[model samples]
Target: MKITVIGTGYVGLVAGACFADIGNEVWCVDVDQTKIDKLKQGIIPIYEKGLEPIVNKNFQEGRLHFSTNLLDGFDQSQFIFIAVGTPSNPDGSVDLKYVYAVAEEIAKNLKDYKLIINKSTVPVGTGKQLRDFIDQKIKERGINVDFDIVSNPEFLREGNAIEDFMNPDRVIIGTESIRAKEQMNELYSGLFKDAEPRIIFMDVRSAEVTKYASNSMLATKISFINEISNLCEKVDANVEMVRLGVGADKRIGYSFISPGIGYGGSCFPKDVKAIINTGNEYGYDMKLLKAVELINETQKAHLFDKIQNYFDNKKDGLKGKTIAIWGLAFKPETDDMRESPSQVIIRKLVEGGTKIKAHDPEAQNEAKRLFKDIETSIEYFDDNYECLKDCDALALLTEWNIYKQPNFQLIKKHLKNPIIFDGRNQYRPSEMKEMGFDYFSIGR
Candidate 1:
């Protein structure tokens, strides 16, 4: 199968690379010439585990192609994937200009039958809208061509996108046409050959809703656990123990129930907001999700509150304090910092006259760019221990694997005091007490 993936963003690039790796010729088209140039030379922009090797391999084997011209892919492939970004608007609605623009361009260039599959996360009924838009555009040009729209929302986790793509538990494809289903099945058959993958066929609207509902549910679980963690602190209980006890339930099986400062990533925040806005537009109240969103927003400040209260009362509060942050990325194995909790915490700390010394395995570059406005108040370090040097205390934000079991001796020797504020609950509180260090962790 020959496929074209437009907009070489995270979803598009990963899908294109994985498609090519599966023995399909894939052309990844983007408008950014600089990005296309870099991809051609095997210079990946984003960091993901096991993505670079696959991309480079497929590109070197001539199965994968990178080009700035949309026509390059448009001319070669019958399956065209709309993988552009649908970022959130100020009112929380998904901005569909990118997807619509791509569709119009495809319509203008349409001369034959093509399967226009959507890999971007979009609101429900987007397939119909695009179908109508393309039809109108094509009629305006006085050319008749056949094109079918298919909604195939992505469920790729940022850190593990490649693995998710290769071993998807289920692939939800929405198209009423048997022709569309048959063609899509052919394209994905090889990818699902070894596994018992469920390729569900449903109506387009239902398929679109699945993506938002899935992300919102995961976000709810996270916020529910964080809310419970906050209560645990008041009731003198440990969230980790509660999580263990609660997760033992066969139905509730632990996944996104880890109590943390908050859930921050490109998908969760955006999807949750979009769904809530969708509900509002339809005159329905998403009451539960509203609470979930509120909980998450407040939870972003929980760790910072712990830091402030730990130093403020008898001391100068957060003013004139230097805090060392162990991680800056939303989660490990990727450098994406969009909607990162570190942003809210670090910004507030900087506003209060406190300095931040941060270190992450891969996110320092992104963090530097994100916090450039406050560059004077923050210092990034190559070494985690070096970041703690001369700082008042240590705060762990992201749970990168390396920070789980760190050099405690070095942490103690480097910081001004043997104090640690852990947000991810990476360490056992009992052990911190035994090690002669003042440790503060959530829900403990």
Candidate 2:
């Protein structure tokens, strides 16, 4: 199969590389000439685990290609995937300019029957709109060409994207065209051969809504647990124990239940807002989702408030204090800092006249870029221990594996006060108290 994936961002690059790895000839198209040139030279633009090696291998094996010209592989490609970004607007609506632009380009270059798959996360009814848009463009061009639109939204997690792409929990195919469905089945047959068939066939609108609903549900879980954690704090109860009791039920498996600052990434925050906006657009208010969004926003500031209270207890405010941030990325094993809690915490601390030293295994450079305006107030360090030197307290933001179990002695020796704020609840309160250090954690 010959496949062309437009927009070489996270989704496009991963999908293209994985398809090529499965023996399909894939061409990744992007308008940016510099990005295309870098891809040709085996330079990956993003950090996804196990992606670079597979992309390089596929490119070297002649199964993968990158180009700036969208028409370069259109004639030969049987399937073209629009995997562009649909970032959120100020009102939380999705900006579909890129997706629509790609559709127009494909319509102009369509030479044969092709399956146009919407691999980007989009609003419901986008497939129908895209089909109509392309048909209108073709009519104006006085060309008769057939194309089927399929909504095949991606479910790849950032840190584990390659694994998710290769071994997805389920593959969704949303199209009414039997011809398009047949091609999609054949294309994915090799990947799903060993596992039980998990391909879900649904209507286009249902498929589009599934992506947003899935993220929104997960975000709700995070907010639910955060709310519980807040109550636990007020009632003098431990959230860890409550979580254990609640999660012990087989019906409620423990995932995304850990109380943290909040959920942050490209997906959760954006998808929740998008879904809420979608509901409002249809004259139905998503009251539960609105509360979920509010809780997450409040949770992002929870850790900063904890820090301020800790200093206030000592009769020395956060002013002139230096705090060490152990993690800058939203989560571990990826350098994505979009909507990271560390940004919220650090920004508030800086505004309060507090200094920061932050470190992350992969996100230090990204942290520098994100916090460039406050360069004078914050420092980036490669070593976590170095970040703690002379700091008032250590605020563990992202739960990186390296920061899980460190030299507590070294942390105690370096910090001016032996205090730790564990946003992710990575440390046990009893253990921290036994170690003779003041410990603060989320709901425990």
Candidate closest to the true structure, highest lDDT: 2
* Shift of residue 142 alpha carbon in model 2, Å: 0.5
TM-score of 1: 0.98
Clashes of each: 1, 0
Question: In model 1, which range of ten residues has the least summed lDDT?
Answer: 189-198
What's the residue-level lDDT of 34 in candidate 1? 90
Pairs with steric clashes in candidate 2: none
Q: How far off is residue 252 in model 2, in Å?
A: 0.9
RMSD to the hidden true structure, all candidates? 1.0, 1.1
Q: Estimate each model's TM-score.
A: 0.98, 0.98
User: How many steric clashes does model 2 contain?
Assistant: 0
Residue 411 of model 1 has an lDDT of 91
